[model samples]
Target chain A: MEIKQIAEELVSLVREGKNKEAKEKFYSADIISIEGNGDKVEGIAAVYEKSNAWMSQIAEVHSASVTDPLVAADHFAIGIKMDITYKNGYRAVLDEIGVYDVNDGKIVAEQFFFKS
Target chain B: MEIKQIAEELVSLVREGKNKEAKEKFYSADIISIEGNGDKVEGIAAVYEKSNAWMSQIAEVHSASVTDPLVAADHFAIGIKMDITYKNGYRAVLDEIGVYDVNDGKIVAEQFFFKS
Candidate 1:
């Protein structure tokens, strides 16, 4: 798949709340994921565990959105916004840009940028 | 200056090739700038030196463009594309997403995401 196709599919899956499916379909086995605060996790399994842990803490999701990607070369970026309440009674709005790198038709890396 | 105003003015200055002026007008004195390759520099003066060093190596700029910002909260992201030839006879097209964090009307941090 081309970068644009992968980007579109990834965004579509994410917007539809199929983040796990999207990762399974597009992410490389040794994918590296980095958070805004500099936490880094390598490999698909580690990434999934990290994501699942976060999901388990979410009490409710009020709203969410993934913007159209800005595609450039083998890289693409999208803006993501989410309003949610955690199980601990913490409600917050999360806004960030997710940048992805595609190589040999697979997503090799994803790094997020935001103000914490 | 509100986030919107600062964002607009910064984009305008960058579009006009007045990056130094933009930094002076919109960036905090202790701004942190991180490159796509994970090189982090603290302070505006250090950032300026790094930028100037890169600029001095560019033989010619064929084209450059900055996309309209995607603003969310006190953060914003923009796509930047540049085609250039270096003094060492190397030519390349650079594409990246720049994410900025604004605080008290000044841009306190910026990070670039790109594939090396």
Candidate 2:
């Protein structure tokens, strides 16, 4: 798959709340996910667990939108806006940029940046 | 200026090593620049000082490329790749995503995210 195709599909899946499918299809087995804090979760299994933990805190998703994937060689970025109410009844709109490094058509590294 | 126009020109100026010009033209007077560590420099003058401090440590810039600006309403993102040699003889390639929030055609809040 081309980098754009792979990235777009992953974003589409996530926006649809099909995160498990997105991970299984687009992530490499040794994928490394890096957060804004410079911390990383190595391996697809570990990253999946982290994603689950984040999702578990969401009580309701009000809206979600993913922008078109902007491709730059083997790297790409996507803008995300997600509005939700957390399990604790805290509601907020989360805007973020997700940058990915692709290798052999599968995402090997994914990093996210966002405002606090 | 439109958001795309503002973002593209800023990236172009920075890629050309005219960062001061970029800041003066595109950044609002009260612009807030946020780093990956969540630290921020408020006001244009403070941000300019921060930019200069970073440039002073760079012995040479080997290459720089800024991707096309991705626009989403009043928000935009640009990818940057910079190859540089520092004053201490350390050479590294820096890749980052810069996300900006623009108000009235000037960048008001800028945040950066990258891996360590």
Candidate 3:
């Protein structure tokens, strides 16, 4: 699949609360996600755990969208503006850009940046 | 040139206050550095300006080293821990993983992370 399609699909699954589908679509077996915060979840299982914890706190992922999406070879990157509204009407504003390293149709690694 | 060599050289130039050499070595004619803090310096010239401001406030960049440096095709990325010591003895500890999207041998896009 084209990187654009992959990126959109993966993010869609995530925002739609399709956890299993998002993980299966977005990551490789050995995918490495370097958490933006030092508390990275190491591997896939850990990612799931952290994600579950997040879900436990928040009702859902409010929205995930990107702009300035650029693709070079096997990498796809974009600037993102997100709102993850919590259960209590409070929201966290995240302005970031994510870079995904893809290989053989799967994302093998990802890095995220948070705006200060 | 190996990305490892390039990463080390570029970072060294930045740390050593060799602005000209570092800029010459790492960026293209139209490089874009997303301020990691949202005040992105759109082009190479802007990058130099923001960087200058940083240096003006800080005494020096203490160190830059990467672990798990990886390269596939035209991209390079790694985890970083840095200390920027200010003239006033205050310091900022930046623990980040940067993913660089290189094109035609130059880094066109760079995303940075800050661990919470």
Candidate 4:
């Protein structure tokens, strides 16, 4: 699959609540996703743990669409707008820019930032 | 200047407290910066206003380095870590991915996101 396609799929899976599958399919053994942890998550085991935390959050992402997905030779960036519903009957809107490094048909690194 | 060089310079200008010079040097008249405002700031005037707000915040970005700056034909993503020390004796650390759209030798669009 094209790198862009994979990226789309990963987000799709997560949006669909298929967090495990999404995590499994998109990440490499040396995968590094710079997340809210303030540090990088390395290796499959670590990524799985990260996925667990990410999935357990009481939230629903109403929309996840790519805006201005700029693709290069081996890298691409996808800007996304996400409407998340929290457990406290509160809703948060998050806009994110996700930068990915695809190597050997797998995502090696990803850094995501949200608007607020 | 090379696109990367321009990117570096613009960021440098801002870091050095030369916000006006940096904004003047890098942005086009129709510049659009998708900032924390949740809406796009259009035109050079709007961008300048945005810059004013950005420059007014009391903070010190201890480190701003590019991590895996993926440069494509028209887009590039830079992951930046900022250590902001507020005047109220509070520190807010932000890790952001800034995506820029350069057209006609100037920044026509930019989007920024933080880890939090």
Candidate 5:
């Protein structure tokens, strides 16, 4: 798949709440995931683990949105926003930019940027 | 200035190699900058120092390009690509995504994402 096609498909799956499916379909096994706070995780399994840890803390998701991908060369970025209440009763809106690098039709690296 | 206007003006100044001017005009005094390698700097003076340090290491800039801004809410992102030769005689292409957050018509934070 082309970079744009992969980017669009990932966005579509994410919008439909099939995030895990999107990851399985597009992310490479050796993908490197970097969080906004500078934590780095390698491989798809680590990424899943990190993601699951984050999801487990959310009590409710009031709203979620993702902007269309801004494609440039082998890189693409999308803005993501989510309003959620945490298990600890804290509520806030999470706004961030997710940047991805594609190689051979798979996402090899991903990074998130947000105020921290 | 509106967020979109600030974003556009910053991009324009950066494309013309007037990064310091752009920072002076748009960035807040307490602005925060986060590099892809997890380095963080605060305040306009710190940002200028960091920028100067990076520039001091570059021998020549073969080419540079900045993509159009992708704006969403109080945030905007732009893709940057540069082909450069370093003082150490090494040459490579640098590609990155610069994401910025605007507050009260000033950029409060900027984060860069790139493979490190």
Candidate 6:
């Protein structure tokens, strides 16, 4: 899979709530995921665990949409809009842009930018 | 100017420290600018003032680079990496993604995503 194809497929899987599958297929073993605040999670397993922890806090997923992916060499970015209700009944709509750095057809680094 | 052209030119002007000229040439009179915190600044004049205030805080810009822009219809995004020394002697490197929404060949809205 090329960078663009990998990005598109991963985004499709995520939009369908198949994040684990997407990670299994597209992430490199030594993947590094960086949050907007500069916190880093090293390794694919760590990234998955972080994502799962976040999902566990959501009471309901109202809606989600992934925008067209943008590519620049081995880098790709996708915009995401998600509406969710948390366990505390707080509802929020989040807009985020995720940038993925690919190497050898696998995502090596991923960073997210969003309002918080 | 078309969306892509406008975006490229605006970024070029900014990188050259000609942001005021860029704003005058590319921004719509009724432009709205949104920050990562969801705070909004309305009108071109207001946006210019915001930019000036930010610049005033910087003692020196050690380095800056504007990445290749990505375009989708009337929307475009550019990544910026800036290393700066603030007036208070605090030095920080900031990475930000700026998204622009264009209408009628002028920038009508702009939004920035970054870590504080």
Among the numbered candidates, top DockQ falls to 1
Put down candidate 1 lDDT per residue, A3-84, tens digits, no spaces.
9999999999999999989999999999999998889999999999999999999999999999998787788888899999
- State which candidate has the highest TM-score: 1
What is the DockQ for all candidates, taken in turn?
0.53, 0.16, 0.04, 0.05, 0.25, 0.08
Error of 5 at A101 (Å): 4.9
lDDT of each residue in B1-116, candidate 2, tens digit only: 88778877887898787878887888899998988667899999899899889999999999998887876667778877889999999998887777787889788888776654
lDDT of 3 by residue, B28-112 (tens): 8788676445456678888788777777888877775445444434555555666788999898866555666666667776666
TM-score of 1: 0.93
Query: What digit string (tens of lDDT, one per residue) describes model 6 on residues A24-116?
Result: 998899998987556999998798889889999999999988876766556677877789999989999876667777889898888776543
Better of 2 and 4 by DockQ: 2
Per-residue error (Å), model 4, residue B50: 2.1
RMSD of 6: 9.8
Per-residue alpha-carbon lDDT of model 2 for A1-116, expressed as tens digits? 88778878887898787879988888899998988666899999899899889999999999998888876557778888889999999998887777787889888888776643
Better of 2 and 6 by TM-score: 2
Candidate 5 CAPRI assessment class: acceptable
Candidate 4, DockQ to 2 decimals?
A: 0.05
For candidate 4, what is the DockQ-based docking class?
incorrect
lDDT for each residue of candidate 4 in A20-114, tens digit (9 for 90 to 100): 78667877889878752237878889878876775568467676555545554455576556677866667866655667777787888776654
What are the RMSDs of all candidates, in order? 1.6, 6.0, 14.6, 13.8, 4.0, 9.8
Q: Candidate 2: give the clashing pairs.
A: none
**Candidate 6 TM-score, C-alpha based:** 0.57
Chain A only: TM-score per candidate: 0.98, 0.93, 0.72, 0.73, 0.99, 0.94
Cα displacement (Å) at residue A85, model 2: 18
Q: lDDT of all predictions, in order shown? A: 0.90, 0.83, 0.65, 0.67, 0.90, 0.81
Q: List candidate 4 stretches off by more than 4 Å.
A: A1-24, A27-116, B11-19, B59-68
Rank candidates, lDDT, best first: 1, 5, 2, 6, 4, 3
**Model 2 spans > 4 angstroms off:** A1-9, A12-20, A23-68, A71-76, A80-116
